[model samples]
Target: MKIGLFFGSFNPIHVGHLIIANHLVEHSDLDKVWFVVTPHNPFKKKSTLLDNYQRLEMVYRATKDYDKLSASDIEFNLPQPNYTINTLVHLEEKFPDYEFSLIMGEDNLKSFHKWKNNELIIENHEIFTYPRLSEGQVETQFDGHTKIHHVKAPIIELSSTFIRKSIKAGKNVKPMLPEHVWEYLSEMNFYK
Candidate 1:
């Protein structure tokens, strides 16, 4: 089984996230996409992130109907400041029968050098990157032995950072997230 590990904070699972996961499962060779909800991304500020349990629940609610899309809490059990390499290693040990790949934005590719044991990860797993507004074409134009694939999905100009800011300001975010996500946020008073 080929599983594409799509890691993110997913402060509140939104439509764009789902779209990319759906696209990968349908268009790529991946059999499923596991939304690895990170407990704390080493590169990002912990204070800005929502509780891991809440974020994971939102992801579950967002992807409940899609059998092809699943949510993972693997990082929650791992050590603090979750690293991709460590997570991938853990996944490999737990599910040896399944092949794992990475699903990320092209912009993240630009900063690949910064991730812990990044080169080691690329050497072992393939990468499936989607385009983002600030992302560049270096990932494709300057390819390496590392298996990197570029894909086209709905470029919904939205990010979790933007949504968090909107919620903090009490601004409208109907378009930022899916209907069910919005309802959950409203009902729980998250980001208040």
Candidate 2:
């Protein structure tokens, strides 16, 4: 099976996320897209994120109805401040038969060269990139790279940061998230 790893902190799994994953799985060659909920992202501040388990629960509720989508807690058990390279290695050892690819936004692709052992990642796995309204340009070397596929998924401008801030301000951002995820967030009084 060819699985696309959509890694995110998922402070709250929103509909924009689901749209991207659903688009990739349906439009691309991937059989399924797994939302890999990171316990901590190296680029993000850990203090601003919700509990790892709480975020994972939101992802679970959001994806439970979709057969092609699911939640993965693989990185939770891995070392803290983990890099994509280490997770790839561990996944290969555990699921030898399943071919894994990366699902990323154009913003992430712009800084791909800086990731740990990026050359190894590029050589081994295919990258499925979606458009993101982010600043900066992609590295010239990655342009037209055979291993990297630019998927024409919808450009979802919605962000978890915006949703969190709105919720904290007592604004209704329910439409921004999955129904169940919104319910969970409201019930827990998260980000309020």
Candidate 3:
């Protein structure tokens, strides 16, 4: 199986994420897209993030109905400040027969050079980059990763940060989230 690993904090699992995953599966060569919910991103602020388990549960709830899209808590067991290279290595060992690819936004590509073992990641896996609004055109040139290609996924301006802020401000964010996710967030009063 050709799987694309869509890694993110998924603070609340908004609709923009769903749209991108849907587009990848429906329009690209990938057979499935797994939402690898990262426990802690080295570059992101930990203070603003929800608990790892809560984020994982939200991802699960949001993606439960989609057959092609699923949530993975692979990083929860891995080392802290989960690096992409380590996760990819672990995943490759666990699923030997499957071809794994990395799914990221063009914005992430802008800072690709600063990641841990960025060369090794590019050498081993194919990358599918989706356009991010206001991030502008990113240079995709990198050594040993000629398989990388730009895909026309939906460019929704929605972000998890915006959703979290809205919720904290007591604003309705029903349109930006999945129905079940909204219920879970409301009932749990997360990010408030």
Candidate 4:
């Protein structure tokens, strides 16, 4: 099985994230897309993130109905400041039968060089990148070892940050989130 690992904080899984995952499974060579909900990102501020379990639950609620889309909490048990290279190594060792590839956005690709052991990631697996609504262009000039494939996923302008901000401002985000996720957030009063 060729699985595409879509790693993110998933503070609240929104439509944009689901759309990209759906696109990857349908259009790419991947058999499935696992939304790898990270407990902590070394590059991002921990204070800005929601609880790891909360984020993982939101991902599950959003993707539960989809056959090809699934959620993973693999990083929760790992050490703090989860790095992609370490996660990939652990995943490969644990699931030897599955071929794991990476799914990222073009915006992330711009800073790919700065990630820990990025060369190792590129050498071992393929990358499926979707375009995001960013201000500037992404530099796709990767070295020979990197296999970055651009996937034409529906570019939804919404993000988890935007949803959180809107919720904090007492705005209705029913349309931005999946039905189950929105219900859970409203009942829990998350981000308020």
Identify the leading candidate in terms of lDDT: 2
Models 1 onward score TM values of 0.89, 0.95, 0.93, 0.92
lDDT of 4: 0.87
lDDT score of residue 173 within candidate 3: 99
Clash counts per candidate, in order, are: 0, 0, 0, 0
TM-score leader? 2
Estimate, for each residue in 1-192, the C-alpha lDDT of model 3 and write its tens digit.
999999988988999999999999999899999999988655676787888888888889999999999999988899776688999999999999999999988788778889999888887889999998888776644623577868988898998999988988989999999988999998898889
lDDT of 4 at 148: 80
How far residue 41's Cα lies from its native spot in candidate 2, in Å, is 5.9
Report the CA-based lDDT of candidate 3 relative to the real structure. Answer: 0.88
Query: Who is ahead in TM-score, 3 or 4?
Result: 3
Order of candidate numbers by TM-score, starting with the best: 2, 3, 4, 1
Better of 1 and 3 by TM-score: 3
> Any runs in candidate 3 off by more than 4 Å, and if so which?
41-45, 143-145
Tens-digit lDDT string for candidate 2 (1-192): 999999998887899999999999999999999999988655676676988899999999999999999999999999877999999999999999999999999778768899999999999999999887674355656999999998888888898999988998999998899999988998999999
lDDT per residue (tens digit) for residues 40-143 in model 4: 65667667588888888899999999999999998888887668898998999999999999998877876888999988888889999888776445665573
**TM-score between model 3 and native:** 0.93
Per-residue alpha-carbon lDDT of candidate 1 for residues 22-101, written as tens digits (9 for 90 to 100): 99899989999999997865567668677888898899888888999989999888887667898999999999999999
lDDT values of the candidates? 0.85, 0.91, 0.88, 0.87
